[model samples]
Every structure is written in C-alpha cells, then in structure tokens.
Target: MRRIFILIIGIAVLYSCRNKQTESNNIVKAIAQDTLSKTVAGTADVGDVSPKNDETVKLIQKQLKVLLKNDLKSMTNEDRYFYYEAFDLNNDKKDEYFVGFSNSYFCGSGGCSGYILNHDGSVINSFSVTDFPILVTTDSSEKFYNLLMKSGGLFHLVKMKNGKYPSNPSIEEKWKGEVPKESTKVLDIYEKKLEKYSF
Candidate 1:
C-alpha cells in the first residue's frame, strides 16, 4: 500500500509539469501569430490605393500622411508639424509638389525622406538622404537640401525642374562643404519656369 501511494504522487507531479510547459509554448505561439497578422494587414491597406493617372497625386499625399503619422507617433503635434514641407518642383504648368519629413530632432538624422506629388498628384521620383532636409530658397530657386553627417562631409542639393515626364531629369546638383556653384543657364531655366507659373 505505501509503495502504491508513492508511485501515484510521482506520476501526478510529472503530469503537472508537462501541462505547464505546453501552456507556455502555446502562449508564445499566439503572440507571434498576432504580430505577423498585424504586419500583413497594414501592408495590405497600403497596397489598396488606386494608381490611376487622375488619382495618383491624391494617393501619394495620402500615403505620405499615413507613413508620417505612423513613423512619428512619439512626437508631439508641434514637433511633427515642423518636420514636413511641400512644394511644386517642375514648371510643367501643373502644380507638382514635393513633400519631405524628418525623423530626427531638428532636420538631419536617421528619419524618413521622400518627394511630393506634382499637380497631377503623381510621384515623379524620390531618393533618400540621411538627416532631415531643409527647404532652402536662393535667389528665387527653391530646393530640398540636406547634409549627410555620416559621409565624409558631403552635402546633397537636389532641385526639381519643371519639364515633360520621362525626359532627362531637369537637374540634380551636388555641392561639397560650401555653397553650390551657380550656373547662369541653370538659373535661367528655373527663372523661366517660375515666371511661367507666377502669372
């Protein structure tokens, strides 16, 4: 009788331990599944945007807003407001625009970077630069410029030119350590576009 009681107690303990281990594993699996589901659902929402010619600009702006909202969740409203700037690039007689957002405090750090839509609300092209870019106006031409601190003291100055689609990019200029070199022809092209749009 004593031997039988000891054997029963041992079996009960072993069963309890095995059940607890299985429960813990199930909890971990549930958490992983939930995370994966959320990620897939978020991506699907972005993909649903219609890429029609007429709707492209609106869609791009909407996407930018969604991305910024998600990425800058930790920022206060005022801080978030200072992070983005939008403007038209080309003189296509349409209101093409560029939108830029900074992820770091001030404008130059690890963060988000992109271009805005033209009047047609379509994205022309976009490239990423380290740090937050500031919109600078020099003698009437406006551009998106940023400094890459991680690089060997190089500055990237990007200008959007107004012209037909699929043509050579209007202009993409890079300057190092100082003000960009000014070219009369480049200025003239910008001025021409500005004048055409100003009226």
Candidate 2:
C-alpha cells in the first residue's frame, strides 16, 4: 500500500511538470506569432509615419508599456493608432517614440500631453501636444527641430538637444539646467509662422 502511494505521487508530479512545460511553450509560440505579424500596416492609421522596422516597432511598444502601464499591443487598432508614433525626424541618429495621454480617467476635449523617448531607449522627455493625433513634422532646413501638433490648432516646436533632457527637474540627477541655445524660443508654445493645425 505504501509503495503504491509513492508511485502515484511520482506520476502526479511528472504530470504537473509536463503541464507547466506545455503552458510555457504555448506562451512562447503565441509571442513569436504576434511578432511575426507586425507590419507597417499602421499607415492608414493616424500617425504621420508608420513604424518601418522591427526595432522601431519594438521601441514604440516599450514606450507604450511605460506610458500606459500595459501592453498596448492588445488595444484596438483605432486606440493604438491615435496615440503612438515611431520614426526618426528627431535627428538623434536614433528613432524616437512618442505617445499622447490624458490626465483624466479617459481622454476629454481638453487634450492630453506627449512623451518622447530618448535615443538610448531608457528615458523620455515630456511636453504637451494637447492631444492626438500628435502630428510630427520635420524641418526641411534643420534636423531634430520637429514640430508637434494636436487639434484646436495647438502646436509646439521642440528641438531635441544633442544630449539627454531632464525627465523631471524636481527629481534632480537628470536635470541639465537648460542648455544654452541660439534661439530662446519656449518649446511648447505655438506660433503662426511655424504653421498651425495642418501637418
């Protein structure tokens, strides 16, 4: 009777191990399939530029994870499209990912703000583009001087500094004390000469 009990226990443990292995395999397979399906199909969506490569897509997804605190890959096409952009107009020599978010429980007419991921992929700089669709326009004459725009004619001309920008000055460490620039323009303020509401 004791021998029989030991044999049964061994079988049960083996079965449980197999089940766990199967579950892990299934999860890995699902992730591989999802990645394989990634495409520049977002062109028809709200972004000014579609994510053209896997690196760009993965980086944008990482930024989305930081901002939304969830995997935006599961969101519907319309919702995802309105909030994200992955491209290289920033002239950081690396692509940037931008996302717009609202402070309220849900986005209202008041509009949300923008978060731009830095080149190294570890930090982001914040500015208000008001709301989506956050239109990114590159300057033909100057590189990295991208114009960010939202609805209600809200616009901001943001220049990506050659180095990291502070995420939050209140937090210390990351604060660079505002690098000197030839232009004293306030980044998020809108101007008519820079164009308005139209990308």
| Candidate number of the best TM-score | 2
What C-alpha lDDT, on a 0 to 100 scale, does residue 94 get in candidate 1? 52
User: Please, what is the TM-score per model?
Assistant: 0.33, 0.38
Candidate 2 local lDDT, 61-166, one digit each (tens) = 6655666666455555444532344555445666565544433433455555556666555555665425444434324223554444433443343334554433
- After TM-score superposition, the amount by which residue 19's alpha carbon in candidate 1 deviates from its true location, in angstroms, is 92
Off by over 4 Å in 2: 1-82, 101-106, 140-143, 160-199
What tens digits encode model 1's per-residue C-alpha lDDT throughout 1-199? 9999999999999999999999999998997777567445432111122222425434554655565565566666544532122332333445444444433432343334445455644566554443323333333333322212111234444443452221111123445465433211111112222111100
Residue 93 lDDT, candidate 1, scale 0-100:
43
Q: How many clashes in each candidate?
A: 13, 0
Distance from true location, Cα of 98 in model 1, Å = 2.2
* Local distance difference test, candidate 2: 0.45
